[model samples]
Target: MIKTKTLFTKLFLSYSMIIFLSFTLFGLVFIYIFHLNLYDDYEELYDFHYERLQEQIAQSAEEGWSDEETADLIQPSLHHRNYNIFIYDNTGELFIQPEGDAEYEPDQEIILTASDEFVSEGATMNGNLSYIIADSFSVPGNEETYVAVMVFHDLNHQYQQMALMVLIPFIITIAFSGGIIYFISQKITAPLRHMNEAALQLATGDFSRRVTVSSRDEIGQLGDTFNYMAEELNSLEKMRKEFIANVSHDLRSPLTSMKGFIVALLDGTIPENKRDHYYLLMKEETERVIQLVNDTLDMSRLEAGQIEIAPAPYNLTRQLQRIAVLLEPQLERKGVGIQLEPEDTDLFVVADKDRIEQALVNLLHNALQFSLNGETIRIQLETTGDMLAVHVQDEGKGIPEAQLKHIWERFYKGEKSRTGKGGTGIGLSIVKSIMELHKTEITVKSKLGQGTVFTFQLPLKK
Candidate 1:
């Protein structure tokens, strides 16, 4: 619901309101000024007509025209202009009608009559123009017989036009103002839209997307800041993954040797027949401790980028055979058979011989741990184009689906499958790291209660 009020809508509304109000105010002012000008024209026309009529009447007196003759000239002027002219005697009685009705009572007439103090009354008559202002002036020579002149100015039609002019522009300006506001808001908020999209992508874990930096404005600066944050997060994530991998591998080696030696010693391999048996047991424990220390140091060096891999062409088949020999005792104790699958014995891969052998040894030992007696742990080698894949497969209870992904994670164990099983949970992690260093790939395939296979592939020398 909140998202509905988008930037566009807000911008449009805000700007539209401002424009609408400004236009409305301007329109009202224009209409006021226009109406005032229109009224001024009417006032000047009325005054001119009144003064001209007085001149004509004075001229008629000089030319010996009667009041009736002067009234004839004024009568025509008032005919089409919606006005009435009249003359009143000293007693304010009707003397002549310029255009039409002259029998109006003094109270019913809108007379602009003047004696010493000019007086005028406004009246609304049904057959007339509904409003009247009369001007009166005394006939110069016949002061006793003063002349009263009445004029009517129709205000209704003028007022109606003024109102229409005011209302029309007001409506049009409001609409135009609203449209302008919308356009301006969209222009101003364009950068924010880009920033919003970038933020959404970042929330979804896409740190690769960067906000668009289009201007030197504040919104552009915000975009730059967001992009910088994404860069930092990407770097941090990389470091975190490296740390987990290093910690996992560093813990696997010694734990494997320790469990192996402890099992052997407990199985009476070191005799209870001699005190030297205790010394041998102590030596085995010391070796386990030493192996653990070395693995930790190696992992630290690798993560620190201080270690270099010296890749060379090495016989991968021979390497697997050596690991099988190394773990032969452990395999026998676990009652598992070790078998080397038939392949090109001279098959070679490009890698650091020592590192590859160590990796192969870890893989073999890991497979042997889960295998029972008479179950074959097969070591197979395959070549695809320029890659050499060595697979360590165990016929022991297969890895659970839920544990496959977590198997390479440090200190992670399948909740149900890990109980009572002795493992440092770091062997596969080391296998992963070593393969990464070699630019190799490792994969696993297993079904519950069926069997498990771990495959590590290294690039082969062409």
Candidate 2:
């Protein structure tokens, strides 16, 4: 469909054709008027010459001149004009032809004749090479006689001059008009050409490609809009990839754990009395699935801007103490010591207490999972400037460099860090999302063989 006539081509053809036809019509009208005016001027000049010859004929006749004498009078006048003049009697008989006006020599009997009704006005003859203007009057000396006065003006030279004047300008006008059309067409089509190329790139899945727009015109605005659409599609594609990876990992871990325990029981690896232990393991896998579903629901709510945060002044120290006490049983079972260090005063921040407590629990749980037995997990609360920060430091085999950045991503657990019964892997992602909704930030600092520290900061109350 795009291969058919496009907008630019249609507009170009429409405008160019309009210009061409308009200039052509103007040129033709101008030349036609010029030719008509020149012909009218030539007629006026011929009338003047005819009137002068009539006066000369009347004067010679009043002088009682003979035919030869009248011929002498007319010859000089006709010579000055380079015109052919003649006179005819009333009868259709031979009359006098002016000297040098006949085909024969001057001494020859040049018998010029005319009909009784004399010809007048101008007439073109001899293929329009000559124009004859004739006027007739009664001779004053002989009342019974009428004579014809005629002038023949050669028009070949005038015709050639007019043709050149009209033809040369027309040729020049056409050449100039064609050059203007070509230059303007190129200027208009250049930007459209670039837009065409950008569209092709988009079709081929190059969402990163964008058209460069330099003006605020319609075409430029179109380029900007296209670029914006490309950027949006690129962002959506990245989100799709992240979601797929997270979902795949989330589903695989629990299935693997459930399968292993079920197979052990079926193969009688455990005695009948110990079969209850396998059931507990299967129950744990079911709980991981439940936790994963709940975390996904919370994430959806946060992203859709539907989760309302209930903010109030909360004792930051009390929440920290509560988390340490709740996780003490698990910490002691792993032989990991829990320590809570407080500031000079009870640090307070404006936040939802329940949500903050949940986030702290997730952090402490993550720390305890990686810590070895006999290692210490330190929990600290401090105020710096206008913010209260909580730090959970675990002296365990710390997160490796490759896995540090991905800890907060959903269902992301390094191969070596995956314990058979540890977590749903969405705990840290939920914590990160909750902190973001509260306008707080969380960060991690860790090194291989050292310990890992996860810290979160919130706005301190006045």
Candidate 3:
């Protein structure tokens, strides 16, 4: 169904046109530059021979030499190059002629024109046809002026045969060149044609569409790049569908709870003595909905490159301590404790402090979500070369290896926590975005029964 097939057609037609124009240009060059006009060269050669012979005959003429005797003197030498001459008088009587189809005469105008000074017609003759050139010449002052005419025979036809011999091969070459052009154009445009079809499928929301790459040339590279784009687009499309479904489910929870609380209160099911408790719970649900919306907006802004990181020097160790203190209540409720490595120490780092704080809180909260009772979540700091590494380790039901790659995706509730965990499912995604803003990445190491560790790096303050 791909209708945009013009690239091949355009390439084919353009290459053919270029080849055709090249052929025409080469033909002109061959004719003009390479001495292919044999007809004119032959005619000029005959004229030169006639001039030399006539000069000899005029200089060698004797008293009372008949016109016929002059003709015999100027007769064709052996191995004639297909040319002859004639002599005549002013009355237009032919005194001498050549062996040919003999129905010719000298015109009276040519006879009169040559009476005083020598005159000759220089017009080119037709193919193999003979013509007359009348001129009367006498050596200086002798009263014996005779009309002489030279005839060129078969030179034009001979030139035509030579040209035909060359042109037949040239025509064959042009035809062969057309075939070569057709194949080359197809080979060049083949990938583009496939890409066009794939692109059309992409337009119809078929992100799985891909092109075949057969070579390492530019066209093949383009095909490989297109397939990569399609794969990423397909992943994004899946994420889009998942995000919509999760948002609907998350919104329905808070909304349904609020609706239930309202129905109970309006019908006096929640008694006046217990109304305050129900009101507090409804407010909490409303706050949860607001937090969900804000988190989605935060992810959106981060992904759209709208949130610029404002980095500065900060005490990273102090920041981690403060985050642990702020989460003291949640840690207490979960029966988990936070322990800082090499306690009572401080280290400085350069980063966006507020964003880093957000990341730490999210990681700690995630640990609190899955940590068993009486488990100690450890926060460690180490320096290696130019950067400082921070690790958050927890004694929790660790993520599956297959699920680890997806933990940072929005709404990715892995198999372990998907059933029991009460999370908005974007906490790790926000943490990942924050680390990316610092020009680094967060990595996780975990096993099925063991705990998980989340590690990232920050630029140490110099």
The candidate that wins on TM-score is 3
lDDT of 1 by residue, 1-462 (tens): 545489777767666677777777777788778766755664566577667766766677678887667667666765445555556656767666654554333443334235344444455555433333355664466444445555554555656777787778778777676667767777788878887887888889887888768778787788788889999777656645654664455456545666666776788775666647555665755666676666656665766778778999988787777777877767777788888876446887889998877677777767776777788988888888888777888876887787788777654444227334644455677778888888878999997676888887888888
Candidate 2 regions exceeding 4 Å error are 1-284, 343-345, 396-426
RMSD of each: 14.6, 11.3, 5.7
Weakest ten-residue segment in model 3 by summed lDDT: 122-131
Better of 2 and 3 by lDDT: 3
Comparing candidate 1 with candidate 3, which one achieves the higher TM-score?
Answer: 3
Q: Rate the local accuracy (lDDT) of all candidates.
A: 0.68, 0.69, 0.75
Model 2 clash count equals 0
Error of 3 at 368 (Å): 2.9
Please count the clashing residue pairs in each candidate, in the order shown.
Answer: 4, 0, 0
Tens digit per residue, CA lDDT, model 3, 1-462: 533456767776777678777767776676664343444554466557557655756655644467566666665541245655666555667655665635344456666776665554434444335444445655544555556665555545654765776588778977898788779878988888889999999999999788989999999889989999999888777777767777777789989999999999999898899999899889878977887898889888988989989999999988888888978877887789999996677788999999999888888878877788999999999999889999999888788788888898876667346337445577799999888888898999997677899999998899
Q: Which residue pairs collide, candidate 3?
A: none
